[model samples]
Structure formats: C-alpha cells, structure tokens
Target chain A: MSGFCRLERDRSLATRVDGGGGVMTGALAPIALSLRGVTKRFGAIRALDGVDLEVPRGAVFGLVGPNGAGKTTTFGIACGYVRPDGGTVDLFGEGPFDPSKHRGRVAVLPQDAQLGRDIPLLDQLVYFARLQGLGKQEARSQAGWALELAGVTSRARARSRTLSHGMLKRVAIAQAFIGEAELVLLDEPTSGLDPVQAERIREHIVAQRHDRTVVVSSHNLNEIEAVCDHVAMIDHGRAVLAGTVAAITGKNEEVRITLAEGPVPLDMVKTALAGDSVDWDEASRTLVIRFVSRPGRGAEDVIGQALRTLLGHHARISQVVKGRSLERTYLESS
Target chain B: MIGPTPFRDMLLVAWFELKEMLRTRRALVVIALYLLGGLVASRVFVGVIGRLEDVAADMLQTTRTATPGALTRQVLHSDAYREALVRLFPNRNVADFLLGLPPIVLFFAWSSLAFVPFLIMMTAADTVTQEVQDRGIRFVVIRTGRVEFVLGKYLGQALLMSFVVLLTGFVYLAVAWRGLQGFEFWPTLDGILIFWPRIVVYGFAFVGLAGLCAMNARSAAVARALSFVGLTVSWVLGEMAYRWSDGIFGAAWTAIGFLVPFSHKAALWRPGVAGVLPECAVLVALGLVYLSVGLVMFRRKDL
Candidate 1:
C-alpha cells in the first residue's frame, strides 16, 4: 500500500511537469468522478469497503479486479443503481445520483444488462436517446450514429432477442454512446466478446476518450493496459493500486531485450552495465535489465548505452520491449 | 443534451412498457381469450335469464296470482333490493331503471364488474417481475429515477387493463344487442357505460396491487402467484367481513374489509357519475398508496 501511495504521488508530480502528450496528467485534469470512503454492504458481505477512486476528465480510466472484488459494485454506485451505505460520490463536483444535476451527463453500460428482448435494436437505441432528452428526430439521428459507431448499423432493425451475445454487447455499447454524455461507465464491455470483437470495442472505447471520460471495469488486464491511460486495481473491496498505466507498470524501469541467437553471456552483459540489475533466460534467449537513471542521465540514455555496449560485444538483439506488463503488476499488487 | 424531466421520463417508461405489452404474444393471447370468454359468458347469462324468466312467468300464470312484471315490481320495492340500490346509487332511482330492463342486462353488468378485476390481475401479474428478473430494468433505472420506472410501469399496466376492459365491454354489448330482440341499445349502453369509470378504477387498483407484488417478488412465476394470492386474500377478507356484518365483530371486520380493494368493487354500479366519485377517489387513493409503497421498496431493493 505504501508503495502504491508513492507511485500515486510520483504520478501526480510527473503529470504536473509533463503536460498532455506522453502520459495523462491527473493533476491538470479536473476530477470527472470521485468516490470518497464509499462503503456498501450486502447483508453480511461487504461489497465495497471504504473504496476511494478519482477518474480524471477526458481520461480512459480502468477499474481492474478479480471476481467479487467490487468493481461492478463500484460501477453500480457511480451509475446510481446502487446506493452506498456510507460515503459520498461526486460527479463533476455534484452528487452522481441527483437527476437534475447529473442526468444527461453520465451514461453507463452495465455488465450484464440485456436489451428489451422484444424491441428492435433501433427503437431501443432511440428510446434511450429520448430518455436523455433528445428530440425525436435528433434521437433517431443519434441512434443511427451510435449504431454506426458500434459497427452494428446493418442490424439496426433486428430485434434484440435475435442478435447474438456479441452483437448485443456491441449494441449495448452503442446505447451508452448515444446523446452527448460527458461521463461513460462501461463494466466488462468485452467480457463475452471474442478477441476480434473485443479489439473493436476497445478501439471504440479509446475513441471515446477524446470528449468523454470513460471508466472501464474489467478483469482483462491486457485490455486495460492497451486502452486505458489510468487504472486502479481493486482487491478485497479496496483499491490496492492506482495511477497512470505506465507509472503503475513501469515503476521498476525494467526492459527486456530478446536476442536472435543463444542466450547472451550474463557476465559480458553485466560488465557492460556494471551497476544495473540484469537477468538472462537461457531457454527464451531473453535478457531483462533493470536500472534507475542517475541525476545527469535518463532511462533512454542508460538503455542506449547498454545497447551500444552489447552490440560492440557482438550481441544480436532482435526485439526490445519496455516496462513490465500490467498482468505482472496486478499479480504483484493484489 | 439535457435529460428528461421526471414526468417525461416516466411517460417514456410507460410508452416502452406499453409497446412491450402489446408485443408479448402470450399477453395478447390472454386478452383475446378474455374478450372471447366475456362474449360466451354474456350469451350464456342471457339464455339462463330467459329460461328462468319463462319458468317464473309460467308458474305465475298457473297460480293465477301475478305476472313477471308485478313480481319484479314487488322485488324492486323490497327493502333489501332498495337498500342495495341506494347504497350503490345514492342520488338516482336505479331500482326504477333495473325494473324497466330485462334481468339479463342487470346480471351481466354486475357479473362483468365482479370478474374484470381478476382478468386485470392475471394480465399485469408479471409486468414488473419479468423486467426485474431479466435485469432489463437496470437500463431504464439508470436513465430515469426508480420512482419514475415504477410509476411508468403501473401506468402502463393500468392502460393495458383499461383497454382490455373496454374491449370486453364492447364485445358484451355487441353480443347482447344482436342476441336480444327488444334490447334498447342506448339504455343498455348507458347502463353499461355507467360502470366504466368504476371499472377503470377497479382495473387500476388490481394493476397497482399486482405491480406491488411484481416489484417485491424475484421471479415472474412467484410474482404471478403472489399477486393471485394477494387478490384472493383481499376478496376472502372482504367476503368474510360482509358475512359477519351482523355479528359482534362486525364493525372491526367491515373496517378491515375496506382496506382491501374488493370491498369497493360495487361502487361502480352507482346511479350517477357524481355518486361514484368517492369510490373512484378511494380506488385511486388505494392504487396510489400501493404504487407508492412498491416504489419505496423498489428504490431500496438491490437490483
């Protein structure tokens, strides 16, 4: 927990220094949604215990957790579907559940909510749009645009009951994007989708980050890492770790270089980067190098120097990958 | 875009519910069967009354004492019959109207009002429970307030039941008009239409009760069963109260009977529109109370 706090602090500080391009700046962006000391109890089971989260404006935030870790519960609270027993939830600095304050401002794709089985896809979308206060013509137009965005425009006339699970999920995603929602909460958007459809949905989610604040909750760490700029890992109804994806996963400053030939000599690689922590995997022909930049140097400088030295020693590097994966970070943190 | 107001959002939910109800094949089939059953029952009722009236007329002629009209006059002038008419129609002489009409029309009016509420209960039993069980309500709940969702659902069920009641009334009126020789179309129509407001109120009351059951139950089957049980319990209690009205516990039982909707079903048969207003108001109040309680429970419940 202390380690996560340090990372969070560092990420905040880093965001203040580096504005918009490389990593998301939490300090500069306004908080789109904040949950403070939110607690929820279902009978004797505490679904969320003092959970705190801050999703920044225009940032794709991911809520990752194992099953029963309260990700969906948190989503429920944010969408005003579930009332927290204790604590406060603010959306755009107002209570999320207050309809007059937050009605059209927030949209949510609940994890397993099925569309009306007897309603046509287009009618359902149009109805959702109308609920958001769109005029009839505008609602129809927005519904069409949403369907096109979700890549399900061709099946607009199909009844929801006839669509496959993946298609229904896509349509549900489309429904969330209808109207001009400022904040969108998507829970397990790609859970039942195949890899291809999941990838497409991820692309759509990423596309939403430009104008809308997206909070995605899923168990797919890789997808979160791929699409989310900021993430919080929850375990036991508590936020175990949270920050920019890069900061959370790249804190150790480790890089892996896969060689084209047999495992490089560990001694030679160590001699080249004498103070760095290096490990060699003989079977995969991969070398992992961990280093912290000195006052006058940076990570690129260190990696550049190591590469020059390794090449001078006749090492053939095939691929170079930066940072540890989110899976590894999640496993370690939770 | 701005979001809808509470009223607009509730209307949207009601519109959606109406569409869903109309689209449901089973519900449509049930409504059709109810109309058909009303027509068949109307025919059977007219035939039975015709036979009974003939038998009475034959006995009167053989005894050489009186005619059927004189007997009807005697019955209409009786204390129990006049009391019942005054209770239903405080302002008008409904006994005179009933005396002028054939017995079948009077019998059909009472029987239909008594039976339509059950049909409404059956039709609306699963309205909310199906959505709750399917988790379809989650989408609308997020968009609109839970209170709006409940109100919209109740309104939709009420509208559906009203439509079914009117359709059945039309069918019954048509069957009687064609089957009976001297059926005064306007008078019989006026007699049936007098009960329309009360019938609507009664239908809505049953819808509200069923909606209350539906909101609380987890499954459609359970909701149906619970709503049926609720209706049965109300009827049984009301009947018991009426039966015990002469006993020592009569006051208490009557007070308890009024708590259920069944006690007030006869209010629709009153003489004038103004005479039945209080009953309509009572039924509306009961429906609203049931709906309000359901809304509170639904809002607190974990979806």
Candidate 2:
C-alpha cells in the first residue's frame, strides 16, 4: 500500500530476482531507505551483486528469499554494521551513514546479535537506550517501555543467559524499538519462535506501521504476506521483485470463488459478468473470473454482479477470494 | 560520520563496559589476584632489602657502631648502592632518590612499572572482541560510531586498571605500616603519590595497545592471544631495534621504542617534573597512535 510497484501489471511474475526489484522510486511515498548499485563480495564469492532496493516510509516491507540470499547482509549495510564494497545507501535521505548525523535515527535487530549474557535484560536495554542519546532517567524509562512492548517485563531483571531463546529474542526486538526510531530494520525477527510467539511479534510489528517504516527480512513468506503490505523478493543476492502485497498478489486483476455441492449456474454467471471471462471448473467446483479493465469499472463491481447472480440461483459459495494467493505469486516469481 | 556527541557516547560506553566487568566479577577477580600478588611481592621486598642491608653492613664492617635500622639507611645511601643505581639510571641522583622514599613504596613503583602493563592488557583484551564475535556490537554501533566504541573500550579498561593500581598501592601502604616498623607513613604515602599517576599513565598506553589488539579480531580468545602475541612481538622488535641502532637510521631505530608502550616504562624513572614530562607526552602520543590505528581498521571492518 505504501509503495507503487514499478513493474508493469501482467501475468508472468518470473523475470524480477536479479535485485532489479523496483518500486516507483520516490514517486509514491517518501523513501525510508534506498540502496543503489550496492555490491559486496566476501573473498571470492559475491554476496550481493549490484543489488538495488527501495523501502517507502511507514510501510511494513518484507524481504523474503531463500537461505543466503543476502538479506542479513543488506540489513547490516543499512544499519552501518557491514560496509558495502560498492554503491551508496541513503537512509531517510540523509546521505551516506555518518554516525554523528545518523546515530539514533535507525535501529536494527540483527539476526545473530546476542545481548550481553551476564547483564540483566533491562540494564542491557538501558545501555542501548543511553547510546541512543537518552538521559539516565529517560533511558531507564524508555528501556522499561521497550521491555513491556516486547511482553518481557517480568524478565526485565533476569540476566540474559537465564532466559529462554524466545525471551532473549524478544529482548533483542525490544532494543530495536526504543528511542523513537524512524526506520527499524529487523532481520528474521521471528526466526526460531513458535507459531503463537511469532503471531504476537507480528501483531506488535503490525502496530508499528502507522508510525515507523519497518523493513523485515524473513524466510516465512506467509508471515510476510500476512503482516506486510509491501514486499521485495531477493534471489541469488538480488531483489527480483518489489511491490505492494495487493499488486504483487494480483488482488485487483481477478476474483476466485470456491463452490460446494450446488447448482451449476455457469452460463448465468457469465451473463452477469457480461464482458469479463468467467470459467467454471467442474472437478474442483470453483469459479475463476479474469478482470478486463474498462472505463471506470473495477474488479469490485464485476465481483458484486457475479455474487448477486450466483446467490440468486440459491447456489452455495464456500469461499470468495480476490486475486491469487501470495504463495502462488512467490512460486511464479522464483 | 559520528554521533551527535561522540565524547558523551564514549563515556556512556566506557561506563557500561566497566559496570558490566565489575558486575560479572571479572574485574574483581583480577583486582583480588593483583592485590594478593602485590602483597606477597611486598613481603619478599622487605625480606630481600633487609638481607641486602645486612650484607652491606658486613662488607663495610659497620656492624659495631650502627644498629639494624641505621645500618639499613646507611647501606641504602652508601656509595655501592648509589653507583649501582647510577649505573642503572644514568646522569641522575639515584642515591638521593632511593633514600628519599621508603623502601616499600619504591618496590611498588618499580614492580608496577614492569607488571601492570600486562595486567592492563589482560583486562582489556576481551572488551570489544566478544561483542564483535557474537555480533552484539551491531546494536551499539548502530547508535554510536566505531571510533567511539573502541575509544570507550580503552577508557573503560584504563579506568579499571587505575582502580587496580590504586587498590594495590593502598594495600602495600598497609603492608608497610604493619610489616616494616618505623615505616615513616608520611614519606611512604608521598612516595606512592609520586608514582600513582605514573603507573596510571603507563598503564593507559598498554590499554590502547590492548584495544588495538582486540579490534579486528573474531573472538575474545583470539583477541587475548593477539594481545600477548602483540606484546611479545613489540618487545622483541623494540630490543632488536635498539641493538641495531648503530647501523643505518640509528636515531630512528631508537625512536621506534617510543612507538611501543613497553619501552616507556624506563623513562618514567626520570628525575624531576621536567625530565618526566616528555615521557608522559610520548606515552600519551603512543596511546593515541595505537588507538587511532585500531579505530581506522575497525571503521572499515564488516561486523
């Protein structure tokens, strides 16, 4: 929703993984982070090959790829951890990163970053808050706020080594949310948590979208599609596709209806659709309608007419879906 | 690129490092061992100096007129000790310097000059590398510059060493009061005062060296190994450079010692404020050089 996909709307989602993944490039919203021609090589193997990406402000952007697709490396470069071998990174349009100018504006939850084992969780967070330029009292208050946000306030006084893996992870996530950060980059925020814990984190992350631009890199595409309105798919160290969830999933171009044991009103439904293509699969008992964009008429109007026609015949409709599944789009893109 | 207030950031990091070290009892353990070792060493000093006086009295045939304490002072100020001191420290009032301080305080200064650098390096070796190895530094460096993190690490180690040095001096002062009769508390305290800052500044140089070693390392164990290796290599090279000074770049070769923190330990023995000022500057400059080199490499390294 926050970024307009630069790719032309069509059926084939196959051509985008070369990190040529494009958004409208500052045309739709203010840019939160932009990486142009960024390339990095570790020894002989290239980690990122001219990867380019753009994250629009206040969008829950997901970076999803297979293992070692340079997701973590990209986060590292954005947060000033890893130095890129080539190209520029523009954070909040504040030029290249200089600690003096860009210190407290960005926060990151690095995948492998572990908090101090012997220090209490709260104290560690307070130290991070202080480094973010808060005074002592404010730092403590902010640290407490972060702990509560992560749902780990009870474990605040517990040492990091004493906590469970999930709790420590929540503490790590807590640190990233402190100090009113404008751009928050989380690399695999729920890498190894249970479904319940993961959903909790997703809910928290979803709540942050109204205020902060959050970029998350995860292996969970369903989780990505669930929480993020925008996504960029990276394959082989380059972003192959980037777009809003609806655009990427083709939500505007088609509608799908799954049927139960009911009347076969295919010709009648076609009459309701009028100009659009409507096909019924007898084996699966489903209706697939393709959108034909006409002057001012949209997919919603077509779906409304089809639904009224089908229901008028006393047909049983099990499920109604807009466009396609994210998994289907991802499989097509990859 | 830097944070808005790098200096304040440095202090924040430094304070946290020290607090963490103390909380974990790493510093406390080291300090306890250092104090225990200094106390044992002080006991040895008392025994050794007392026997040396007896030897001096016997060799000079002064046992008939002088008592034990008088003989020790006489032997300490005698021409033999003076010549030996002068030979050890050239063109200086070595005998007067020896007699001006109580013997226990002198032992602490000399022993600290040789031993504390190692202690400081050991204390500092793990400060950055552990966090770096685990990628925990990413969280901090996101809010602070690499330079500040490194500098703050050094300052934290330096402050910890300062505490250890202070505690050792106080422990030795107590040893003198109880173990050495007629210890002249004022003169002995005065002696500790003179060398306190010297010991602190001397340790600062090594703290910087330790920082240089800790940065760009993969693990804390590796950083620790590098610290000892760096100290040994610097020492060997310093010695070789001094020995080879008669060849080409003789002055430059000798000046190379100024680059290593180990070589400056002797210069602190220089008499008077005027003689010691240059050494302080050199030590401070050496600390900065090592730290700057570490910072340069750390800035470019991928964490």
Candidate RMSDs in Å, in order, are: 8.2, 7.8
Taking the tens digit of each residue's C-alpha lDDT, what string does model 1 give over A132-160?
A: 76668877887877677666777788888
Best by lDDT: 2
In the order shown, the chain A TM-scores of the predictions are 0.84, 0.87
* Model 2 lDDT per residue over A151-216, tens place: 777778888888888878877887887766778999999888777778778988888786779999
Local accuracy of candidate 1 as per-residue lDDT tens digits, B7-120: 787788888888888887878888888888888888886665456656776877744222223344456558887678667765556555565555545765676678777787
Give the count of colliding residue pairs in each prediction.
0, 10
lDDT of 2 at B78: 82
Q: Estimate each model's TM-score.
A: 0.86, 0.89
As a whole number from 0 to 100, the lDDT of residue A79 in candidate 1 is: 81
Instruction: Using TM-score, give the best candidate's number.
Output: 2
- lDDT of every model, 2 decimals: 0.76, 0.80
Query: Candidate 1: deviation at residue A301, Å?
Result: 4.1
